[model samples]
Target: MATYSRNRLTQLLPFILSLLLLGLNSGQVQAAPKAELWPLWQPTVATGQSAVPDFKHWENFLSQYVRRYADGLNRVDYASVTPADKAQLKALLEQLSTTDPRGWGPATQKTFWINTYNLAVVSLVLDHYPLDSIRDIRLSFSSLFNGGPWEDKTLSVTGQELSLNDIEHRILRPIWPDRRLHFALNCASVGCPNLATQIYRVETLDQQLDAAEQDFLRNNRAVLWQPGSNTLQLSSIFNWYQVDFAANENQLLDYLQQQGAVSPGILSTPDLKISYDYNWNLNTDS
Candidate 1:
């Protein structure tokens, strides 16, 4: 009888472990910041000549430091950044901080915020250089679980102090509510969508966004299918912001199919299992 009991426990271990992992992943998804609109950002003007701010400095910076590798990742040469280049980055951030984007159109505002988020990430990573991952630079004890400097107020935009979370969750997500924007904002992490070498412009914003989404989806990091196991693996971005993508798992598969990111045959398999994962290693040109 004792031998039978021991065998039963052994048989149940894998199932038990799977349940625990699912719970942990679910907790992380639940812990992701929700989109909450800040009222002050709602106002916008009908017409303005100087609505779009200059991105020449940003363009120059990107040209100098950002490099796109054959692996479909745009990595920054963070270690090679000189003091002068760092000052230029700081100048760009300062320019963005004082510029009031509320007076601009949504397209311009969207582009601005996306660039701001990506730039801020690079800046933060540089400040705490020689780290294995962005997750290593903890702002507080809670950061161990909360993750990096995302929660700390790192930028002042139009007199309103904002964090990376504020830019992504509060302003960008709430204002746009487009899943494609997820591909546009880079977190200086390997699992994140590639940081564009070219600056996002008002004229090409729509095309740029569409291209970003398509590019990310095509990469194995975003979606992978296991034919033998009939399992579908997706980036944790889809899991974290599921509402932005689809209403349910089936809808998500449909969405992927519509994007031409996944093959219909694989998505149509009977009783297919889905999994989510993300890598947080620093996206640096080593």
Candidate 2:
């Protein structure tokens, strides 16, 4: 019996190491994050098949169109975008809105809608570029951003009328049990998490979002300044969506301190100088 036990333990050791390696490499994405930018694409999910999309299709598409849009910013002298491009993109969004991924579940649907909201926002910006922010784009009367109903927006997800805020504030954030998601929904500001190069998947979402929040918080470029400073310069996200974070905590600084790592401690900047920094430039290969 003792010999049998020893042999069984020996067999399990290698199996344990193999599982550790699989976990270390699996679902760990180093690229950018998926946000409210892609309005109609489903998150890249593992179909349990070897041939899975790491977002190559959408990345290629975005690369081409974003470059053209950026060119519009600098040189108005290129081959103008035909209405065809707009029509094609819009058609694709519509397809995403109606797609029913077989064997895929509700979580899949939720992630898909979130991605769609963001994609639609990006398209909206490109349509009205040479502008400042997403807030500049006017939603239809009674749309989510402008004191309107959740639906009836120009952006459609899975064949339903959904406003950007509805997808973000209503379905994905509230109903979903995952908390790491604070990272993926961008409002098109410099302070927001850099939109990921790939789409998000429900299976891999927790890992992806946790990684995103940590990366953004650690980096000084997107979010800066000392909590102890008399003047605190923070991400514009805090300024724009203060209410989302306010109820749980009394103030924004408290939220920062909770997330921040200080040598000694965090100091409340009494009459602290709060500055918002964000660049509305396109986030492409640059």
Candidate 3:
């Protein structure tokens, strides 16, 4: 009897392991990170005069390497980046590190943070080029299971070291709490909104943000409506940051309609099946 029991357990091990893995993944998906403010990043007006850091170098780098293909996604020509341009990018980041934006106006501050986040993402990807996904660039074993480089304190701003998560969740999201900002910040993945070719500026930040949100919503990667099956497929971004977007599914549908992401009929569809998915493939022009 003991020999027979051992054989049965061995045969079921794979299936049991699969079930356990699936449960863990489901929990991970449902538990999205909240936007909690980190007091360290709180802005205070500096007595000394300060100027918004110029992003002309960053803009030039984007103009040279980023291209919007027919697929509607902005792909970075990472492999073709010249060493001179890469050095310029490094210099741009170094310049941003020393500059303090606390004395800057709200518009200038938001523009600075958005551009910095995007620059950091691109820089990180260049450091680990030829990777299939950003998630593959794991710094630690824990990063392999959780966030990749996002949790690492890789960026220095105003003498404070911060990770990508610190910028997005702690600073930007908490300070602004604007859903449109989500489209403005790119994650270097196919699922993320396009990284704008032009650098965000204080003068044109609002218009640029509006355009970014509209462009992403119009793209099939952000929202897909299957009329035949009455199914709504959305990017996992909406699932992860649902609180930022709306209170519930109906309100979410209303918000989507307002953005022209879907038709008004979608709000009335009975037995509507909603599913969320995201592609983690590197947005590269290969």
lDDT of 3 by residue, 137-213 (tens): 77765563564577788779887888888999999999888999899999898989999999998888899999999
Candidate 2 segments whose C-alpha is farther than 4 A from its true place:
1-56, 62-88, 100-103, 139-152, 177-179, 220-222, 226-229, 239-264, 268-286
Best first by lDDT, ranked: 3, 1, 2
RMSD of each: 8.1, 22.1, 4.5
lDDT of 1 by residue, 245-265 (tens): 999978988999999988898
Off by over 4 Å in 1: 1-30, 47-52
Query: What lDDT score belongs to each candidate, Candidate 1 first?
Result: 0.84, 0.52, 0.85
Task: Tell me model 2's lDDT, rounded to 2 decimals.
Answer: 0.52
- Candidates 1 and 3 compared: the better one by TM-score is 3
- Backbone Cα, N, C clashes tallied per candidate: 0, 15, 0
Q: Each model's TM-score? A: 0.86, 0.57, 0.88
Encode model 2's per-residue lDDT on 173-257: one tens digit a residue. Answer: 5555344455676555444565554567778876777777766666664455665555455555555555555653246666666
lDDT value, residue 11 of candidate 2? 94
* Candidate 2 weakest ten by summed lDDT: 69-78
